[model samples]
Target: MSPQLGNERRAADGVHSGESGRFTSPVRSSRLSPLAAPAFRYFFVGQVVNRVGSSMAGVALAFAVLDIDDSASALGWVIAASSVPMVVFMLLGGAIADRLPRAVVLRGCNLVQGVVQTATAVLVITGYAEIWHLVVLQAVAGTVFAVSYPAFLGMVPILLPVEERKAAFLLIGQATSAVGILGPAVSGVLVATAGPGWALAVDAATYLVAAGLLLLVRLPPGDRSNAKPSVIGDFLAGWAFARHLGWVIPAASASLVFNALVSGAINVLGPVIADDTIGSEGWGLARSGQAVGVFVAAFFLAKVTLRAPMRAIMIAFVVWCVPMLVLGTHVNVWVLSASFVVAGAALSLLDLAWNLLVQEKVPEEMLSRIMAIDGFFSFVATPIGQLAVGPLAIAFGAGRVQLGCFALAALVAAFALTRRRITDVRLTGGPPPQLTG
Candidate 1:
């Protein structure tokens, strides 16, 4: 039987030993934090592989568009095709995660992605690749991710102690940022030398590896077999809880706005900034600087516990905007890179704290669904931002758009943090939450 089903059976049989003590006790030692859990190790490794592969594939795909059609608009559509599916299906994906075994969902998704990427590689290799083909393939890949990511994220609580959720996400954020540092440079070299087809093939191989690692993981349990709800009902349940939470609702909405504006700039304008001001190599250096910041944050999170982690996260969220403001005004690659590094470090802090806050405060039964709702809405604005950035830049110039995004993001984050009670939430350091394991 799948691990999800197995976990459901365990929950039905009432396995709660060692849970209360780990959950309710005041967080004592940061020595054996949650990231050390066996299940998390497997999940983390798989995510690392998948992230690296996706980065390589993404770079290659953009190059492929340039090679095939040489039109910037065509490239934009191709890239946007991937994200559209996520906006459409992220909530539904979360519902599925709540209802299913997380491990099974992750493994199944990885397997399917392997097939899709492999097929994509073959089509490109055969010289039948077209812009439409890239769009269709990206949409398929995005659909799988919509389901996979929620399950992956929701699975973290099941594997680790609730108190460690922050550290765990810190670990993940750092790893992802590291990949961001390396993926582009690697992709550029691979595409330049081995061709985009080979890069896609490599992506397929990584998914296979991810699937294998996931198969080794043994999840504890979640409320997967609770009474099933209609998709709308499930989504509404999650939304209702999030909306009521003093901390989560506003934080999520503000983050949504911040991410929408910033991501669009990073995706569209960062490259322009690099190409126009510093050159393509400088772009890579700026990204690497950001990754370095993330790595530094992860090292701290892996070691120490901060009092009021969520408050720290909110502070970081505000701090993150400063770099964008600086970068908006700068022309030098070194200056842009330094700003990006600071922004990335701040982002790492935010990711760790935010994930920990929600995982600790929200009921585990609703986690996947809630995450889905959050993910869906949070990312919904990204494509809009991406779509608008080019036009905004064309009309007012890249500098103006970058400055506008920085100001808008800072305002949203500042407004969200102004809530008085938002700082009061924290993890109970007992055995763990009821549904965690």
Candidate 2:
């Protein structure tokens, strides 16, 4: 074939189709290498800022409840309130994200989130923040995430090349993990020093800043002229599309049960354990350890390529059982921290793989809707777990409850691996035909 034909074929496959190795436009080659494109830089910076605040809020909110109401179930109520709305509205969010310029949706959500967080901070600082008020407000805040998450998922594909998705995801993981490392500890200090109110105020400020940054980003218009008007129809359609796939369905099903059991158990139990044994500071330290592990894994996995997508996820998920077992056993703080570190690495790896896999396999137009469904499945049951676990711990032993949750998570994860697609599915990191003329 002639050189021109070769270049044309290569271009069709989404490779750098330039005659020379170097792409005249750095954006094409800059996928693996971050910050080459202006859009990515802005998005990355805004996201890191926003995530750090979110991470800090997680630790802060738990302690805030502890301050006013010492009941474990109270904390559970607060967490459940937020998550339920997030699950309920997620599909609506995803449908909107796919239909509009994602940046518009993202910016609007961030602005609203900033307002909500500010209100939360005011309530806390004034000593007027009741448990019911918090629960109500968090439900509002949850809707922000419901919409924004779908939009956020769709952003990178528009900004970066197909080949760089892994790198982009890993980089994002790294940034969030870095936030994980500092955000909790810093939040602890702030909660200890000024109050949880200040940490919340900080979160509010980040959202405002993120909203501003999002305005600076320009994106291609979305194709939504054919979208349906009914929310329920769109939601069911998302789930319908989700359920047929071999890899997607099982993974989501596993996540649904796992979140109900594991995530809620951890959220409610982890803080209670901290208060009981090592105190809040020790809990923060353990969280810091988990963050460290995540940060380290992000850097390492960013460079490492995986061939067998589902099997790698299964193997990593098996290790998640260890941390829960150790925590439930009441082993020392050092040991628990170590356990958290291991759990962090495995969880981060699993998350990276799952996200990259979605981006690689799903069509860009449908990515947000699918991701919304994925989010719905992944977290839908969390409120159930949160609501149940604390009470279960009160009834049964915390140790027993935690152990049971771990066993269930492991069993479901193991069952997920039993599917043929788990081992057989491969991520070639395909160079899908993606670049515009």
Please give the RMSD to the true structure for each candidate, in Å. Answer: 4.6, 5.2
**What are the per-residue Cα lDDT tens digits for candidate 2 across 386-424?**
888878888998888878888887787778777886667
**Clashing residue pairs for model 2:** none
Q: State which candidate has the highest lDDT.
A: 2
Candidate 2: misplaced stretches above 4 Å? 1-32, 225-237, 432-437
Clashes per candidate (backbone, < 3 Å)? 12, 0
Candidate 1 TM-score, C-alpha based: 0.84
Q: lDDT values of the candidates? A: 0.70, 0.76
Give me the displacement of residue 92 in model 1, in angstroms. 1.4
Which ranges in model 1 have alpha carbons more than 4 Å from their true place?
1-36, 69-72, 122-128, 195-197, 220-225, 276-279, 302-311, 318-327, 421-437
